[model samples]
Target: MELVTDQHKKKAKTILKWLITAGIGCLFLFLFFILSLWGFAKIQGPPPIKVPQTTRIYDANHYLIGKVEHENQNRTWVHMDDISKSLVNATLSIEDKRFYQHHGFDLKRLAGAVLADVKSFSKQQGASTITMQYARNLYLDHEKTWMRKLTEALYTMRLEMNYSKDQILEGYLNTIYYGHGAYGIEAAAKYYFNKNADELTLSEASLLAGIPKGPSYYSPYHNFKRAKQRQKIVLQSMVNNGYITKQAANSAFHAPIRLVHKHKPMNRTAPYFQDAVESVLQNQLHIDQKTLAAGGLKVYTTLNSNMQKKAEYWVKQVINPASDIQTAVIAMNPQNGAVEAMVGGRDYHKSSYNRAVQAMRSPGSSFKPFLYYAALRNGFTPSTTLRSEPTTFTYNKGKSKYAPSNFGGYYANGPITLAQALALSDNIYAVKAHLSIGMDQLVKTARKVGIKAPLADIPSLALGSQPVSVLEMAKGYSAFANGGARVTPHYITKIVNQKGETIYEWHPKKEQVLNKAATFVLSQLMTGVFDKKLNGYSKVTGASIAHILTHKVAGKSGSTAADSWMIGFTPRLVSAVWVGYDKGQSISTYPDSGYAKKIWAHFTESALEGQPKNSFKPPKGVVRRLVDPKNGKLAAKGCPNARYTYYLKGTAPNEYSHRCYKEKGPENGRKKHKGFFNRWFHWFH
Candidate 1:
């Protein structure tokens, strides 16, 4: 019986030993399998993958305007040389002290960790070397298990063999995820310092190099106390490893964990102007969403921060916030299409609908200038007389009638100059002028003035009952300032890629639609109106705001039921200010004019403060001549009632060539120009 008991014990021991051996063999086989695969892949090369490139927008002077990024990280990439050698050395010492001495894993650390893990009830063990950390970062994840550790070891072996020490160190610095959306040491430095990674001091470098073991636990955002504690551990490890001195370690330990609050990556400085730049990016660059959002791009816009601040301040402090006035302000350089500033609304956070670019409210009387411009092109001048009267018109085959009356309804019935009617924004007189000049000609003239809206041959067009964007009207007004050289309003100045290559630079191409002579004469005549009526400069007796003879500025004021607008320009800056409600309703009553002139005056005065006090220079072909506005007659000093007005060269009416052939009465059969169907119609008209 004793011999049988001994035999049973011996068999049990043998079986137990065989089972242990089998398990050890299986684990070794698995490790060998993974290592073999890793080695094979390393011989082949890293798998192909698309690397994301970043983009940024900057101002004309290369000041950072905004950036495109993803994971909330605006990464400015750097090569290994870009960072200091201390950064790499510190990271190596802190992450894996025995990295250089080991193949991939340290057998001694593994043995000690295994023993400690076995003795400990809590199954926490760490055997990661620097190479193993790189392996963990690149491929393996936080499993906290033996199998994952084994995989990490195998991968680390492959990494060591595939890349050199410097390359592996570079990968560690770049691929290691730091807190605050930072993926690398370079980004981490910026995250903590607001400066480049290469700019880090020894203390800063050590602090950042200590984060990867448990970023959240060591993250400054989480708890500065814990971060300091972990940072101290890093300093101790560096000291124990002899990488840093005790004095250095002690100083670093006591140093304050001054963590910078990571800046939000957004170029919200000018939402409107920035949005305008994005529009151009979409159309010209044909960028995709992935590239725009995740590319870590820096973009520079054409906005001068100063001008943008002025525009926004006026919109906020003086314009909209003053009286629930929804204001749209657009300013640009007349020389080029670069938009200097744009304020779409009072607050972009409340609403992003760019009113300056999108809102097409009826330009009211502002559209009349184009009609007057058309007449100038078609042989009419400021001195040209249109019989101003209460007129009625039938439309839709007489089913509807429009008794288009002047704005005040009391017209100077006999005959008035086109200049006076335009200054006062006469609705009846402008409609009559439109009929005499032909609506087709008016539409053609509008296209020339940068009024791109589709035109209908309707009488209402003459009174500017057509809706036009404030941006369009502003650029249209620039023609008068620029002496008839039509410039299309543009927002985007240039676009740059992530590589600092200029994808596009905008050079505003100006087109001369109207002859220079006509533009100059029209500008002079419009300035005359401001001199007489709309000029807001009350203190200056002879000096008008829009028509300071010393400084030429010509513009038009317009109001729809819901909106009131004033587009004015100097030779250099063209500014358009629009006031209205976002929902298109009249919030302020008429003649209760809400900040039209005040805002205009404020903006103009403020905008022109820094610019050269230069006046508009009329182009070479303009010939200014005076004629009697009441009779379209060559003026004589004795006619006290007659007003002298300027006319564009060739636009003035031919002096009634046959003076004796002038018809008998005021209602005598007559016609004004060649387009008229009946000469006798004037009597009835």
Candidate 2:
């Protein structure tokens, strides 16, 4: 029995020994297979995917625009130039000490890490080398299992063999997520210091190097204490590894952490305009999103950044704050429709709704000028005053009433000259003038003068009750800009690609809107609004400062209960500004003229600071004369009501067509009698 048992035990030992030997052999074969497969993978290489090219935004002048970053997604790209060697060394020391010296599977490190873990583990054991981390990031899970370990090792070997060191470094830096919407070192630097990564200090580099292990936990924005602690670890590792001196490491560790302010995108300034330009360029010109975002495109835009800034500032400070105010501003070169600036909102961040290009607010009194323009085409000289008193008309719907009241409260009765009616913004005068002149004619005249909105057939249409864009109003006013020539605001002057080839070029075309004579009379009459009706500004008056401010200038003010707007221009430069809230309601305690005028003053003052004031040159077609403003006829000497007026050179007044007429010459036109309505509407006149 003893012999039998001993024999069995011996046989079992021998069999087990053989099995163990075979198992060892099988293990070696498996490891060998893995190595060979990994070697093959090294050659085959990981596939390279095209990262979404970052898009860069720029100012209107075509300078570098900021980048568009994605939140919680890898949206940044960094290069070797943006990282420091010390950062690399520090990361390696605390992560895996034998990173550079080993193959993918560092057996020695595994054993050491395990031993340390068993001895005293604070948290996760450090068995992952930089290459292993990269491999895990590219492909694999962070599971604590032998299978995951083996796969990570295999992938690491593949990564090391497939990619160049620089490429690996770039990918690692760029793909690694940093908390606070930062993806790469460059972005992090911009977020932390308002600068680029290449400009970071040694302390900053060390602080950032510590973020990857636990981004959110170590973020300076949310967990400053943890971030500082992590930074200390990184600094200590750097010093111990001789990447940095003890003094440097201590200095870095002691440095205060500073987080950067939010970078509100510059893409916001003229979102609608930019959208229009980019869409046109992309659709019509075939430009792609990649080139638009990161190609360092120098888009020489028609926008005047300063004026645009002023317009936006005004809307924000003076308009949007009002509960119900909404406004828009569009300044263009009337000679060629190049829009200088367009501001659509008070707070773009809060809401992207654009009011400038998209809103449809009623024009109110602003539409009245088109009627006068039509009347001029009908042979009514501005010197020909009709009446300023309240009057009712039956038009539009026969049953509906058309009674427009002057916002100034009262009106002048019959015999009020055309010049006086306009200076007072008389609704009755405009209604009568347009009714006699013809509504269809008024619509055509308004269109020719740049009013692009659909007009009502009713008499109210003559008073600017139609909704119009600030851009359209600016163009309408431009009839006086270049002697009746049209101005159309357009963006995207030129579009180029990465190769610098012009994909598209915009050459603005200015057309004739009104004849020189009509334009001249309107301009002169428009300028007269400043005399006394708009007088008493110790230093400023919209009528006087907008037109004849040491130079030939002219403009008009428009206001609706919900919005306040002003469009003014000099012969050399024309600037139109609008101010109000996003929602169209009565936001102003008073009216828009005051606020709009002030904003206009601010914009014009800054924009026209250095340029020589310009004067309007009456087109060769205008005739000039001085006459009794009471009637469109010649006035007598010592006539207190005399006023200067312009007529088209070929269409001068019949009474004064022989020569230039001045008020000083001629017999007494009529017995001068002071009128009652003039007391308030035209106090000084």
Quote each prediction's TM-score: 0.58, 0.58
List, residue by residue over 182-223, the lDDT tens digit for candidate 2: 766777777777767677777888788888787657888766
Candidate 2: worst-modelled 10 consecutive residues by lDDT: 532-541
Candidate 2 matches the true fold with a TM-score of 0.58
- Top-scoring candidate (lDDT): 1
Q: What is candidate 2's local distance difference test score? A: 0.66
Residues 66-142, model 1: lDDT tens digits: 65433346456578898866677678777777777777668998888889998995449887777777676555446
What's the lDDT of the predicted structure labeled candidate 1?
A: 0.68
